[model samples]
Target: MTGASAFPRWILPVMSAIAAGVMLALPYNYAGLYPLTWLAFVPLLVAAHGRSAAAHYWLGLLTGLAMYLVATPWMVEFLQRLKDYSLAPALAGAMVFWFLTAQLPAFLMLCWHLCQRFCGHYCLWFFPVLLMVFYGWFPVLFPLQLGESQSAFLPAIQAASLTGVYGVDLMIGISNALVTAGALQAMGWLPGARHTSGVMGGAGVLVLAAWLGYGWWALDHWDRQVSQWPTLSAGLVQSNETPSAAVPAPEPGYSRSWPPEMALSSQLARAGAEVIIWPETRYKGYFEVDQVPGAFQRAVAGLGVPLIFHDAEQQGNGGEFREYNSSLFLGPDGALAGRYRKHRLVAFGETLPLSREFPWLVNWASDYLGDFFANLTPGNDRVTFPVGGVHLVPAICYESAFPGHVARSVGAAPGSPLLVVLSNNGWFGDSRQPWQHASATVLRAVENRVSLVHVMNNGPSTVVSPSGRVLASTPFQERIGLVTDVPYTPAGQVFRSWFTQWPEWFAVVLGLAGLMALLLIRLTRRQA
Candidate 1:
């Protein structure tokens, strides 16, 4: 194996691609085998050990293409919902999603190649740092990083609050790199093969042990601390309702109304629910304080409990009305208590990307393609709603995927220790997307150390604790409401407090320092 002729070149790249595919399938797909994520990249690492820069570049792109292609078939579900679905549109959307999300893998492998070439064997441990830096900046929806897979491993993921999801991502990267380095040495791919194997193998085991050990201690400590905190009885409502095929264009004050289920509200109240939640757009009205219907107001007034729902409204900017995806909160008095407008709009679904820069293209696309979506207004500030004793960070629809946005919302109201996600997932149909979307709430809960309440239209309403544990959830696609006492504890504040002041600077510095070291080493070699 020491000689180039001893091993086939294709072995490394092929194994690398297969490992990446398996890793994505296990954690992201319905397999639910998240533990496999830790070892998923080992095969790739082994393949990459003796590779040249050009070889690593192609391998990285290939691995990224495989990872995203397997992990996110759910993207095609939306395109398929088009008027009489065709393979062309679905394939087109898949290509866009793959191109955007695949950058992280390509960036990661580039880091590995650079480290191996300039920084030598010791740089294996630095791969995680570089990966973290790149991931911190990479823009994608609901970042499904390597570390988020270990969300089920409570102790291991407890570090998320401190570094957001990047900390856990770093740990996974470090462990994988260590294992890869050791394996390469054993395969006679390194300079001091025998000695390096002992060092790397022992280091990898120690790192894994420490990671698990830290998790156990954190969980045990958090459990004892949380036992003293008071819990809240929250009710989540899900009605199997899909959006109408003919969604009317946004006009000035176009009001639509669908009364919420009063029987379910009464049942939840009778069961000691102080707060009741309805799924996004369950009530189809452009509600305003002065324009709310008398019957709707009277109905909410009679409920005797605070209610949370979503609606759209017209905002006047020089007499032009812009619509927003707003989270509406109604008090017991049937009056608007608070509102949080959705900030993160879905790509090409609500608002077109880069439409601000290329305004003419917006009109061009609309004219040619028949206006697929209305240009909805994105919110500027984080808004919190208070119902009963809980202050809620209302993450509407796709906002749950952006951990930093959710964290900033929670950070805005330090007193507010809860996050509520209202989503209308009917657009995605019966695909695995509902479950995949719900997974983001788990990471959000851990990142902010808050209780997360997810209410969705057309199923899978979930209640997650500060520990990232799912306490209660409605079955997928079920038309039923769920009531659960979501835990209230301050375990995640450790990361929250740290992140609020110093965001990703630590990761930035680590990545920059590694790059600088690599550049210096390359220069020294050139000078020699």
Candidate 2:
């Protein structure tokens, strides 16, 4: 076992490769239903045993490749969408998503490899810091840590209260380490073969106990919370409508001359909905304000309820006709009460950056970016409004992926509130895009301790609790579903307030610091 490091070069590398494949396919597929995402790292970690830094770096690259390739197939869509770019450039652009997202796993392996020689056998405990290093960062584009896989697992999730989502990720990493340790024991890599069996059994018991304890808490909380929950009557409408990505629209059905969407808004209102919600882009299609009567606004004002619509318009006259994606909140009286122009705009969908200036990038859209051509101006404010007697944050789209963005917005409020993510998932085309997007929302909901209602124009619009439990969701297409009343979490979840991805950083530093100290000690030994 000690000389195994000197074995044929292909042996460990092949094993490492096989492990990466299993790690990627097993955890993501249905049969591996368990959230064994962290388990994937076990073989990669094992491969690092008594290795050179260069060897460790290859291991890091391999880990990153497996994770980035499997976790995000959606990047292909971005590449395919850019018809003008060469296959290589488009692919490169798409791969930036991979480079940006996989820094944690890459670093995790590096940290583990650096410290293993010093830890002797204690390297198992060092992984808790790996979790911290990976989870910590600012403006995390796709902050999908290993813990997210266990969103369906309740036991390990109990740690969410202390460290938010990152804590659950930490515990799962620990569990995965235990599993890898057991595997190593079976291989006779460590001494005390007789005691290995007992130790492994104990670890199994600890994992099971932690899992069961958390499950009990979640079940108990659900049962008790439901009875005390205040019910509110609300109606949701998915208009399958598009305003401009800038032009505003009158109410869907009533634009003076019997618009195409006549029955939609009125039906939602008639359904006893105190607050009738509409999907994003309810006003995004080829319609101008002049097309509707000036009194059309007055007519909806009479509906006596709030209706949310996405507004878009191209700037006119001498200007380049800029476009805006916005959420329009009309008061019960139908007059425009408030608005949150979408803060985050899609790279190509909203406005292509610098494409207008460079021209070589090819401005593909029908609209202009700025006065001549620029990116759409993002909204500066996070608009939280009251409707149906609940305080809420209305995120238009894409903002859900950025948990810290929601936290920053919701943080301004005294406590957590119900959340409404008005979206047009219709664009994704029945692919796993909706699932990926919706899955990330759960992280945001749990992180903020808020009930989120994802109302979509096309598919996978769901209502999720602070725990990321799905209450109700529509299938693909022009569908309707009631969330009944989403439960508003009573304030105080650590993540909602804790802005820094500090836990991830601490892990990195700890691992790095530990490795450094051991190196210094080794140097002193050589001198002595």
Candidate 3:
């Protein structure tokens, strides 16, 4: 067996980049390919084992670009649909997104390079900790994580209940690192690699056994627990309508036609729905807090059930006017129960980056970017609406992608809370974005141990159980109402996750360990 010298200098890095990308993308594109993720990084790690710092950076960037481009080519179509961009501009925007996303992998590879330089072959063991630390903290446009590829693998993701997604990432990372070590040793890349790989492989097997054992127990436990809990009969309306390119200005005192979602809600109520949810911005008109229009109020009161729906809200007057993308809750009496303004605005789509702190940037960008710049103000609080004996915590679109944000909101709610995510995937058209968006909620449900109802425009509206199982879902690009009984902990019964209480604890511990490793390396050099 020969080392890097046996192959052309460029061969390993290029092949490894494409191999890792395809492996990572497959699980996301097809649920059954999840097993590939355990070995996904093996190619990249082996390729990077003896690379220089500069080479590592380029390899990392190439790998990341390949992964996202393959896994989320939908982003380009989304930009064209959302912004009405021509092909060239849409592709340019997607490239910017992909490049920004590549930084996380670039940094990860640079850290691995440093570890190898300092700690010799033993640095392979440190790879998992490094992965947990970096992936947990790295800022990216989309939070499509390595662990999320296992969303369909129920048992593998059970650890998210205790340690969040990072735990699953660490497990997968360990497998890849161990496999990479063995491959390197077999290829004669490093001295003493065989012994290190053998010992780690044994420990890795034991760790995996414990992980799956816990997962098996946890799945059964959650299944039984959910069945015993009280249930809320909820209806989710998927209107399957995209917002018109141009909304005509309202005529004074003229009533708008009943939207398709409203008609769907009426039918759902007739079917004995206790509450009905509408996807984000389903109502095209603006709403003022506590000032429901007469026709709208009458239509809602007619349903005879609580209704949760998304709307645009405006506050203040004249120069101080602020617009918000908000979720509104209406009681059975048609009175506004609560309004949750979206706290997490989509970057660039909902609001321009740095626009709040630097208002001048908004003005400057608006001059150049025109209609691409949105001015929706972010809300300051997470609101929980009480319906019947249960509380519904609302997460609008992009907010559901954030585990900590969703967990904190669920934890803040009194009694058993069901997370209701309202989204308008219509902007992304019939693309992988809808499926990828839906997959994220699976992790959020497990991380918080809360049942979640994700209702989206343009389909794939789903109800996820505490066990991360998709209990019910609508077909993509469908117009229908998905009605289901969502289980929740009864009032006075508490269901809180340790990860919810301290979501960042695992990442913090890993970060500290990384710092200590660097210190040890420094001390070793001093002693020598």
Candidate 4:
């Protein structure tokens, strides 16, 4: 192939990215309807072939950037719907999305390429390890993480036991790379493929078969495991509220009573929810400190059930003000029992990043930007609330995407409480944001061998089994106050768990070794 005809170098990455965008719809919104998701990143991985190590690195970077932009516009749309009275902070809000999108993918791409080089054909193994570090375990919005696409195939996701959610992701990256490599090799277009199919082609096919088989078994096991759980009562509430300057902003965005105009605790108890969950910010009037009386205490008192209330707390006012985006747990008796201050506050929504260094910019920017910007401070600890014989982990909003957090919480013993997510999706305004968040919750549940029960202010708040089953979901574009039963995930037979995450450290080491191998190959090739 002449230099002029060298595949144009850029086309494959773009095609792959577009494919990725389409593929991303599968995980939660439309899991398994299309075969496209299974092969989305393959084109880009193929694009990595025949390029120098540096070229491969650049390809991965560009591909990742494209992927993020395509997927996370849902997040941008959701955050943007939070209309402000001014436009500076609003503009800053939009800019923040771009900034976050660019930063994360760039870092992820760096790891992707490093894995490709060091892990070589083992890209699948190393790629996920790096992805978890930069995306899963690390703190970030990650609203559109890739793992959500596998929601259609719970058995496939079953491997999460050993590898964690990162395993599912690793499988995706590896599958993409292998498919791309195989297709190119088959067409006799890849380097050395025309001369020798015995090595590359056989290796690619073998890996593909093994993963496919494993995915099948995982799916089977997942279905069986899911069948064993006793369905418990579950209720996800959608208050259908939004942030608006014209509406007096509710002092805090959420109060126990707002839109839908009902007593949250009363409605929840009447519905007979063994565990009742309110959407994020549903209790913005609640507080962590004394001078401020908790909002839900009175409303929930004597309900004889545990309730999860999302709210915002004011530390003080007038020059001494501090903010916390918090989730409060109230006993059936109407007393605050446990609290989890949101750990991953939205940069433009809840609080601004490094506001002290850029106070003027933030203060001016938030008028139109988003809520409580001064971005609320994150909680320093994780709390598991006691809810009727379960030790439920409280994850406010974005924290549901992190596997390590959920896994640690589930380590409480056999039959721990399911992961509970409380979120306010009104800011996303019926966009794909709620769906995106819903998608990530599955990875967390399946990864940690627990169930996840979520309540969102908008639609898509729902329940998922440890095997990735969506037992129930709220209707899209509607408000709901529901109560249903869900199982307390069982802790028997650790036999088939996929991601145990026991291999994360090893994956990391292997990835680094791959990087070193690439450097050595380049040096030796140059010397020759």
TM-score of each: 0.88, 0.75, 0.94, 0.79
Model 2 RMSD in angstroms: 6.3
Summarize candidate 2's per-residue lDDT along 383-500 as a digit string, tens digits.
7766745666778778776555666677655444667787765543445566666655666666655567777776667777765677777776665544356666543432342422
lDDT of each: 0.71, 0.59, 0.83, 0.62
Candidate 4 per-residue C-alpha lDDT over 332-375 given as tens digits, one digit per residue, 9 for 90 to 100:
77677778777766655566666779777676766655343445
In model 2, the Cα lDDT at residue 437 comes to 66
Prediction-by-prediction clash tally: 4, 27, 0, 50
Error of 4 at 59 (Å): 5.8
Model 1, TM vs. native: 0.88
**Residue by residue across 1-528, what tens digits does model 3's lDDT show?**
487667787885789977887888878877778999899888888888777999888888888888888888888887786557789998998899988887877889899898888778778888888887777778887777777778899999887988888899899888888788778888899786677678878898889889989999999999998989888999999988765334433334433536677778889999889999999853556364233355567888888898898888888999899988889888898877899988888776668887878988877766644554568899988789898888899999988877778888988887778999999888776668788888888899999998999999987899999999998999998889977999988787777998888887887887788779777976886699
Alpha-carbon lDDT of model 1: 0.71
Query: In candidate 4, which residue ranges exceed 4 Å CA deviation?
Result: 1-29, 46-70, 85-143, 187-208, 222-231, 245-268, 288-298, 316-322, 356-371, 412-415, 490-510, 516-528
Model 3: CA > 4 A from native: 1-8, 248-257, 288-292, 367-372
Candidate 3 TM-score, true structure as reference? 0.94
lDDT of 1 by residue, 84-107 (tens): 347787778668778777777776
